[model samples]
Target chain A: MTIAPDRLSPFQDEFYSALMQAHEGLTEAQSHALNARLVLMMANRIGDLDSLVDILKTARSYEHG
Target chain B: MAYDYTPFPYVSPPGLTAPEARHRVVIVGAGPIGLAMAIDLAQRGVASVVLDDNNVVSVGSRAICWAKRTLEIFDRLGVGERMLAKGVTWKIGRQFHGAEEVYSFDLLPEEGHKYPAFINLQQYYAEEYLVDRARDFPELIDLRFKNKVVAHEDRGNHVALTVETPEGTYSLQTEYLLACDGAGSATRERMGLDFTGQTFQEQFLIADIEMDESPFGPDPVPERWFWFDPPFHAGKSALLHAQPDNIYRIDLQLDVDADGKAEAAPEKVIPRIKAIVGDKPFRLDWVSVYKFRCIKLDRFVHNRVIFVGDSAHVVSPFGARGGNGGIQDIDNLGWKLVAVLAGEADERLIETYHDERSHGSAENILNSSRATNFMTPKTPIEALFRAEVLRLAHDQPFARKLLNSGRLSVPCSLEGFPLQTPGTGAVPSGRAVVDAPINGPEGDGWLLEQVQTGGFTLVGFGDVQLPEVDGIARVGINQRSADYPCFTALKGLAIRRYGEGRAYLFRPDGHVCASFTAPEADAILAARARAMGAELEPSR
Candidate 1:
């Protein structure tokens, strides 16, 4: 339920910038679409069903927190 | 400089003047596959006739990426070392998004193997090498250039072929006919067989350019460079590979509606080259426009005729599977065909060729198809996914793994196939033998070279004394004091790859059929029998 330590440790800012730049020219709908696709893609990269389920719960909990 | 396409001398065949005796095997098309098939058969003390319409090696750098597994197979056919020596060896692959590099992967990080991950030698060179090697067994391999197979008939026990030579058309007969006639297979066409698969509409423009300056920047090293939405060619994918003789292969994705004729023209192609190479002086060696097609025949075997290479199946060139898979088909079929012809194995054994290779081709098709989809996304949603995947890959390790310009070709595991007796070990059953360095009483040599020349091999590792099995060659590793041929596992690589105190049974094609922790003669015999299709079940 926790992010791996130093997941993006050295390139944290670069990753954040790249993530923002991905949606730079897109409209709100387009940005949403890109994010949706990114989520699905990242989920597939994760690959494990159990890990994805836990990550989903953790993500929802963070939203309320 | 471009390759000189020197045509092989065509001689008048005996069939032109009079009918010849029935050959054991007749291989159609003298391309890489046909030449390799002939060489493989000749090596096993079997004679074969190789016929081709063209005398010269294939034009252009059609297939440049020779995978390690395919190289090993070629090594067995006696041309691997030559091809490797002439090829531009490369292992690293870099994927870029626009101007920024997303990631790079090292295909062969670990050493101690005979061949590298890949070598970029043009198909023409490969065909030439195979032709020369085939000539080594002149008496066994009757290579008839400029002789085309116009028609062939399956006459129950044997197949009769009508070959059209420069002199005149003549009749020839063979116990088995091997069709290596490529994608537009005349053999398959004449037989009226069903060739089916998906075709992607997206077209790609491929060109081979000769340049003094390196496109890979200062002090350039030969490596596969792939670009997605490159700055030079916006909104399109491009690929660059280095070949021998200062030649570079550049493939740029084109619009689906783009005319191949117009796109391939120098007028259109020169500018595209300029955009990528940037004002660098370069000469165009070859230019071509091709659409992706993943097609294959329903069955590779039909009566007395067997299909090999592109004649059996076709896939997109992205994965370099087309030529590699074809070479593998020869590797699997060569031994079985020899055994069957020698009356050592049942005729049913040839059917396993279809079983194993069809599965291998299907795997190749599936992989190439998936890579094509990723490179050229079809639907809008698919495009979105691809775009995001590329975007995320810039810094994300997880996303980087998802980046696939093309998943390069590797040996297809034949695990659980009909011929293999199921067993588990470091090498495992039905997997191609992994090469390692070893020092024999004679001299230092490669493991594959020692065991994979021909016939069943029983390889014992560490202190395990090899059991004597009739008709099988026994090799002991790290048994310095043994009587038969033995090797000292250099740096313990052999023992590391194949576990200590274990033994392995390898097929004639250099595939592991069974492994044992305890060396038993009976178990080895049974595994050998299974690998020979003695216990073969009814066709699936």
Candidate 2:
């Protein structure tokens, strides 16, 4: 049973705003550090090393593909 | 068949020549939101003078999608059943990437709830029903048609309004002023408040065509079909919805350079309709070409005047959030205004209305703006991401989850508010009441209908005894308990929705204020006091 009709990310605007807010005051070097810490925090929350690695590889693949 | 645009009779008011006595509340605008505002206030036993610039109901099938939560609020105001009986009820929605269907969903899988997930009824019919319902309290709801508000000023504790009519002009004084006007609110314009948000330049053709043919295959039982770049209309999105009277609402995206007047013409629109629905003979019931903006006022409440519906917040129509959101605004504002008017609470209660509904409107704006942005991306990068998502959505399930087509309106959760007791249960505080079917002394009835609209209701489920509190009605739900005005859950539906051994406190607007595992007198009273915004902070 589909609980909500739109399976899409209904929160695109919400997450986009949050991302901009997170980078609002940070410099380029600080932003890199923030991104790294954010990724690690999210990975820890996910707690699945295999899926995390797969997503990490997928992110890198998007740069060239 | 086109809806008859018969204007309502506009009787000349005595105030046409002489100044009238100060009214408690004056609502400007007679659209669905404004009419419903009058009805909701009347239901709460507070009288309001509803003034509209126009006498007729809305011109077209504008704001057609009424969500389930809005239905509950409408039921409280005494017009839910009428709209339900006339509206086309649909729970199924199918999304498509080109000709292939990506996903189909059933919004409400389980039964026993009072209303359906959504209903499609023209805004005119809903407003007519609300106007008729308002007549039920003829003494309270003084609906004046063809009355226009030329200007207004908030006089510290009261507001003075200069109104113009066909006969002449008159002045009115009221304790509070309510702007239930449409998106182009005269009150909002006059106030010159900041209505900041994104405005999309792309045009959309909204046509209500009446044809005996069904769009949803054969056996069309009211369903929503959305297509992204259909074969008939390439490189543009299209939506088809069924309403009552064999009329269908079709929305097609037009490019930024599309001519508004030329597109609305029959020569241009007929081919589009014929393209969508092959040889189905149809008549154009109503047609318009428009662009929507998702904008909102910085504050809904400004001194003695308050804004509700499109006047306070406007959203793109894709998600069916516009009218439904306005209904929610009225539902939130009704009892608070009544309380403040009756001197039952401090004026501070109005501030909570601002807090809760502003949060609600912001959420609506965000969802709608995101959907608009996705549909008509201004930047090439945004368009690429959207197209990729749509393309991958054809096969990849994860990508299908990224397709945004207007998240339908649902009640906003006011979880972290100061009014709530701040605890967890099946349904936590500050969230609207979710309905369940129940069997009681009156036979079969829904849980939402059993609760009070303008007063506090304490509902205890399964073996839980409710505390006797003042101004709060008591309700107990069990399989067999009939001792203290209790209801039999019949098949334990209420128990499923609301777990056993917990008592819930519902405010007048049918939103939960607090919940307790055990009956506590002091805690319940304190929470009630906070919800009313009457008493000062109790040594917090």
* Interface RMSD over true interface Cα atoms for each candidate: 11.1, 6.9
Q: What does candidate 1's lDDT look like per residue over B91-126, in tens digits? A: 999999999998898989998899999999999999
- Docking verdict class for candidate 2: incorrect
Model 2 spans > 4 angstroms off: A1-65, B479-483, B534-540
Worst 10 residues of 1 chain B by lDDT: B377-386
Which TM-score value belongs to model 2?
0.91
User: Per-residue error at B466 for model 1, in Å?
Assistant: 0.9
Per-residue lDDT, model 2, residue A9, is 59
Write the residue-wise lDDT of candidate 2 on B286-369 in tens digits. Answer: 999989898988889888999999999998988888888889899888998898888888888888888899999889988888
Model 1 earns a TM-score of 0.91
lDDT digits (tens) for residues A1-65 of candidate 2: 11223433555456644654566566666767777898899899989988777777755654464
Q: Is the docking of candidate 1 incorrect, acceptable, medium or high quality?
A: incorrect
Candidate that would win on lDDT = 1
Q: List the residue pairs that clash in candidate 1.
A: none
